[model samples]
Target: MKAKIKATWVSVFLLIAIEQTIKIIIYNNFFDKRFAILPPILYFEPMFNRHYSWFNSMLKLNAGKGLHIAVVVILSILVIVFYRFLTKRIGSIKIVNIMFAFLFSGAMCSLIDKVFWDGSLDYIMLKGFFTFDLKDLYIDVFIGLMILLLFTKNEQLKQIDEKVLLKDFLDCLLNKKHY
Candidate 1:
């Protein structure tokens, strides 16, 4: 338990550090510059995203600053609720713990941007698709993994229980045959 807790904290810190470092470097060097790596596929075009995900097109809403603050607050609350729920259910599961760490780290990374930069530094673009940052990728990947874990957890546990029951039944049969 202690080891898992330590590992979780370390992972969260490392993820946040890496996300911030990449964002800072891109902000300093690639701002307003578009570097096409794969012509029409992949490119680096740093821009400040002042809204949550692709919601910038929704409306002016509460100005950029207010929107950023609201995003941060909402994400923070959701992270807290998720952590509590996961802890209550299967906190000892290694994959679940790692998933939560990534999720929390991603949320914290976005929150940091909202609090400090008033927006997130988005650089990677898929031409006609969308633009996102490392933090966004982290969040996306972890969310998918968490969903997978949740879906398969019951199956895995049921398999384990079945195996144990089978073993016990075989043992009883062998003992009766010996007798």
Candidate 2:
């Protein structure tokens, strides 16, 4: 494994631990299913969103405490497979590692909420503002960052590839102008 890969793995683990700690704290302290913490715009409460399929309309899969374990299992498998696929791509492993790290962290965060709350936690509510929990917000930010990074790095990678191709073309023409 490369150093960058090792670093990414470490980051994933750390993030997971942090997420779990937060979950446990919430579970132990406020498992009463009430909004324990409330700032003017936010509230910490337990919830249950059982609807499964996207938009929560179809597939009545339960999103309870046990569902958290299921999510962890499925997501872990996905991350491993995704990481392996990236490794096979030769030069794109670093990007994959970073993305995986972000995804892993987000998964851990949401998993905690599900496990402790017996379902997906949806405590956020505001009179006139958007509401989101810590886990959801973190995941969104991670995805946003990943997209930005991809676009920026893609431009640089394209430039590098072009330079290399131009050099190779010039070398071929100079050495053998048979065409």
Candidate 3:
């Protein structure tokens, strides 16, 4: 159990480290509309998301710092709530693991943007619909997986638990009749 806890935190930290490293590299080298590594599908493009800034404008008044702080605070709250829920030791709901994975990966990914980009990096352009980065993709996929896990996690477990309870109740009734 202790090892599992340590591994979980290590995984979270590793993701955070990788994300922040990429953000720092992009900020220092490519802070504008520049692309390297060829292939528009996969390269760093420096752009700001004003919609994500608390100051109503990206690259304004330490807004990045404020956003980073806000993200960190929110992530901390999520970790706490998740920990509480996991501690309940409820039925075999794999959703708890999925939630932790999404929570940590998403938080780390966004935290990197907030800390290093003065705003988010708008990389990975796709057919003029959504712009994102590798980190963003990681966060998005994990979150999507977490949502799907929510719908399916309990179905099999619910059946097993119900069967166990029914069998136990029947056994008790039969025992009482014999007595």
Candidate 4:
């Protein structure tokens, strides 16, 4: 289990490093260049997102980097609490670790983007919709797997106590409990 957890972290950091490296390379060398993978549908076009996500931009959040980082931190806290809950309930299952890793990596990448990049450097464009980057793909994996788990691991997930999870998170934030 420990090995699995270690592998999860290693995989996540590798994904982050690779994704960010690609983003940085493209941003540096081809910021305005667009290469069509599927012309008129999908393309790799760089975009600098000052907001955290497309949802935030669409809603016109326009929040400062400080606020963005704060939100990411809070999200990360929630993710950790939930992950700890799962580990306690089901042990360190690899699939669960991978699932949480996706969420964790996405949050960490977003936090990094806020602190260092001023915003996310999105390069994947979906015509008539929005542009996203690799971090977005990481988040997407979590969402997809979570939905699948909701049905497949329904019994285990049903053991989740929302109230307890919330309390645990609050306790951690208040330094009243150690996670």
**Once superposed on the true structure, which residue ranges of model 3 sit more than 4 Å away at CA?**
30-44, 53-72, 91-95, 151-179
lDDT of 3 by residue, 1-179 (tens): 55555566676777777766776676677666556444655555556664444344433564446755586778667575545434333332445554565566766666655665545766555543555665666667777876675577466544446455445545544664221
Top model number, TM-score: 4
Better of 2 and 3 by TM-score: 3
Clashes of 2: 1
Between the candidate structures 3 and 4, which one is better when assessed by lDDT? 4
Q: What is the Cα-based lDDT of residue 178 in candidate 4? A: 74
Which candidate wins on lDDT?
A: 4
In candidate 1, stretches whose alpha carbon ends up further than 4 angstroms from where it belongs are: 58-64, 150-179
Candidate 1 lDDT, 120-140, residue by residue in tens = 888898888878888888888
Cα lDDT for residue 57, model 2? 30
Taking all chains together, the TM-score of candidate 1 against the true structure is 0.73
Q: Superposing every Cα of model 1 onto the true structure, what RMSD results?
A: 11.4
lDDT (0 to 1) per candidate: 0.73, 0.58, 0.58, 0.83
| Clash counts for all predictions | 0, 1, 0, 0
Candidate 4 lDDT, tens digit per residue, 1-179? 77887888898898889888987899789997978989889999898988776667999977777877888899898788777766765678766898888889988998888888988999989999999998999999999998888678556557868788677767766889775
Model 2: per-residue lDDT, tens digit, 86-162? 45433445655767777777777666555555445444555354334555655676688677776775553444454
Instruction: Supply the TM-score for candidate 2.
Output: 0.56
